[model samples]
Target: MIKHIGVVGAGQMGAGIALVAVQSGFETSIFEPSKQAQEKTKAYFQKKLPPHQPLFVTQLDALSNCDLLIEAIPEQEALKIKLFQELDSIAKPEAILASNTSSISITKLAAATKNPERVMGMHFMNPVPVMKLVELIRGLQTSDKTYHAVKATAEKMDKTTTTSKDIPGFIANRILMPMINEAFHALQEGLASAEDIDTTLKLGANHPMGPLTLADFIGLDTCVAILEIMDKKPCALLQQYVNAGWLGKKTGRGVFSYV
Candidate 1:
């Protein structure tokens, strides 16, 4: 029944979600405070999408009447709570608010909103256009109606939906980040070059992308932020690299460099 969608944050995830929604024939709106991010998001869809997608949006205020609002901000609890508070006032009484948080607590996030029953987590993996599975997480108070609604929304977007319990890192990233942290440790011990480390995982683990490469795609700053919250310290290599502002592709540098 939800025909319109709103996406907050306009980061890689938000823009990608907005593209998916608009391409699926939903009227979509996206909110991004930074003028640069907003412009980049718009460009991403314009250049990356075919002409058929009705990517009709100019600014943030278009979100108020959207049937579902997707929050795809950085992984910060305080900021997310603040956003929910604002959206609670702006969105319609029956609109569903979904957070695309990979590691944050869905229950805690749900409680931050005025109506917890209307809030839930819909975690889409990176490169949204390509990822097939979408994790649907229900908070303690998230209504069953919201679950089905979100699942249906995912289906409409051509994504397979999987249910996850409210927990730290949910499914993929919990196991994934820890392994990546271990990889950092290996590098600091002079086990291998960054490329060698990545290659090892690709061939040995039969994985498509190495952890460091995946981390870069996820944004190294985001990795640092998540690790800080998890009380995890990567090998000293990452600490020093972070100090150099070599966060990742977002900054044109990481384990691998990008121009």
Candidate 2:
């Protein structure tokens, strides 16, 4: 029954989610105010999906007709709550509003809207087109009807779905960030060289990439954000990287130099 999908923000996660939505045969509308971001997203679509085109607009009003609206903006709680308040007014009475937040509280986000039942967390993984899992979190007021509808929609995108309670960091980040933090701690304590630490994890733990490499890929700034919101304190080493504007792969330098 969910035919049209609206995506806010045309950044990496947003573009990836919109691409999958189009591939799943849903009518998609994406709102991105930045011309640079719009061009980047367009280029990405042209490269990955040459034929299909989702409606792209600079104004939020263009998404009024969408059956489901997914917000894929940055990981800032205040910004998200403000957007949700505005979306509550613009979205249809029955349309579902979902957030792609990694660690923020969905129940708290739902509190910003007039009808909380329809708001839930539809946290898609980074590089969404390639990742297989979609973590679905139900807010305290999220109804069964809303949950099932979003689950079916995610399945249509060919993603495996897992349900998590509305907790800080939810399931994926709750487990993943702590291990990543510990890796930063190890590096800071001079337990091993960055290369050695990464190599040990890759060879010994059989992980696809070492934790530092994964953190770089995930963006050091994002790691800091997720950790700051979680119950645990962020590793000082990680914050230092973010403080220096070394946000990993995107910034060309993080724990290691990519330049």
Candidate 3:
């Protein structure tokens, strides 16, 4: 059994993963350089997790001793490469390196690391507790040991794991983004207000949230990033929303106002 888990980045995914790891008996540490991020992540854990859970650290070097270091940093290739390069030097030869990337190329990331055999992708959906599915991506050089280890970790987290080849948008988001883009198209066409669009989806389509609202939750910047990578044009209204700095609940405005 893996005894130690390290997570880089103290954002939503990293914090949630840390909470679940510690709750499952793994000694977990979250490494974030930014002080505010460190405190915010710890505060999140303090509120939602047990008081006796594992600690959080402020240096990436702290992850060297971990059995598994999961990188939940930004989706940019250069950033991931830089972090992986440092992690490769610090981590043990047998330690697994995992990426929480949504759409980046796993093979490229693996190749950037010293041990491609030990690198794999672990894509956890948003609202980690509520989302049950995780996508496990294997690079061309990923070894069986690394793949199975991450799969086992997800299982221990009580998450359903689906194996997928690295592709733009991975799996779910590949299909979901087009739908969200369509919703914006419909709204721009004057078929409905954002409220009406969402209502139609939740009531008529049996979804928990409407596409516009879901896009907001996903972050407009993230949506545009994914769309641009997928070679899909951003719906005009969304382009405008992104231009205006109304990024969503995180920014207090989007398809709907936070207040």
Candidate 4:
């Protein structure tokens, strides 16, 4: 019976999640501190979402009535913890506070809140509007009721759910990021050109896109950040690309140039 969904952050993932929430018929509120980001999200929604306007708030106080608040901020542990602490104090007592973290520990994040039972991970894949799988991660103290409620909500949004214990990267990225990293290694070692590496995976593995190409789409800097959070050593070449500010399609350059 969750309604009045609130989403913090108005970046790519946050905007996508807010779009899904509204499409599912819930009254949605989006909180974004940056006016520039808010403008971008507004333009996106005007073009892609229903004509009905969603409340865009500049402060968390507006989200107090939300039954489910999903934090879609950048993947930083300290920032997430701070936000959760504030959310725990602001949101309704029974509200479920979820994080869309890709690699961070859900349990650790839950600890920041007073009511750990209401804290869990609702990790949506990139391009949230299109992706079907939503990883429902239960932290150490996440209640069964909270887990089921979020699962049902995901289903209502036409998304499939896979449950996982709170672990680094949960289920998806623990395996996916490493493969992307390996693709970078192959390119760095001169095994093949970026195009050839991707073509091999596309034809041999039947993947929709090649690893290098996918890396560019996902953003090279994001890939390195996830690997580092998981305590995995990132590919040196990937590091170099990030250092050069070639953060993939967002920056118009990465493993392959989009420019």
Assess every candidate by TM-score.
0.94, 0.96, 0.94, 0.96
Candidate 4 lDDT by residue in tens digits, 96-179: 999999988889989988899999999998789999999999999999999999999999999999999887888999989999
What TM-score quantifies how close candidate 3 is to the native fold? Answer: 0.94
lDDT of each: 0.84, 0.92, 0.85, 0.91
lDDT of 1 by residue, 57-139 (tens): 55545688899999999999899888888888888999999999877788888887788899999999888989988999999
| Candidate 1 stretches greater than 4 Å from native | 51-61
Least well predicted 10-residue stretch by lDDT in candidate 1? 50-59
**Per-residue alpha-carbon lDDT of candidate 3 for residues 124-223, written as tens digits (9 for 90 to 100):** 8887777889999998999998888899999998999998888888888799999999998999999988899899999998999999999888778778
lDDT of 3 at 160: 98
Comparing 1 and 4 on lDDT, the stronger one: 4
Give the winner by lDDT: 2 or 4. 2
Which candidate do you rate higher for lDDT, 2 or 3? 2
Tens digit of per-residue lDDT, candidate 2, span 122-238: 989878988999999999999999999999999999999999999899999999999999999999999999999999999999998999998998888889889989968889989
Candidate 3 segments whose C-alpha is farther than 4 A from its true place = none
Candidate 4 lDDT trough over 10 residues, lowest sum: 49-58
